[model samples]
Target: MPLSFYGLLEASLLMLNGIAVLNRERFLKKVFSFSSLSHIKFQLIFTRFFSVPLIAINILVILFKLLVG
Candidate 1:
């Protein structure tokens, strides 16, 4: 089995960012503050969480391929 260079880099950055967010006090506060908002806020929160990373990954992959190939 072969490992992709971009996949490894993406996974590593994601993990590192996830860990950093979890440990940061301001981030934790914002994450918890979402619960106090209305249902619309909750929906927006989840949508952003899933969509932002996906868009980021797509951009990173395109840039990586452009640079490498």
Candidate 2:
């Protein structure tokens, strides 16, 4: 497998997770909720905030490897 392939996979997973995180209210109402975790909101916020840079970094690294290696 190539770096680009891995990058695509990572980006896809990130997009799925982003969808899940965005629709968390529906998930909680229709599915399940972690009531024990008081910081669930904060965790979701952190995930939404950090995932973009993580995806960007993954793409940049993959491009660098594909171009330079």
Weakest 10 consecutive residues of candidate 1 by summed lDDT? 19-28
| C-alpha RMSD between model 2 and the true structure | 5.3
Cand. 1 Cα-lDDT: 0.64
TM-score: model 1 vs. ground truth: 0.36
TM-score per candidate? 0.36, 0.43
lDDT of 2 by residue, 1-69 (tens): 567977686677667556546665655545554464744875577678877976676687679779988
Where in model 2 is the C-alpha error above 4 Å? 1-38
Model 2, residue 65: C-alpha shift (Å): 0.5
For each candidate in turn, give its C-alpha RMSD to the true structure in angstroms: 8.7, 5.3
Candidate models: Cα lDDT each: 0.64, 0.67
Candidate 2 at residue 63, lDDT? 92
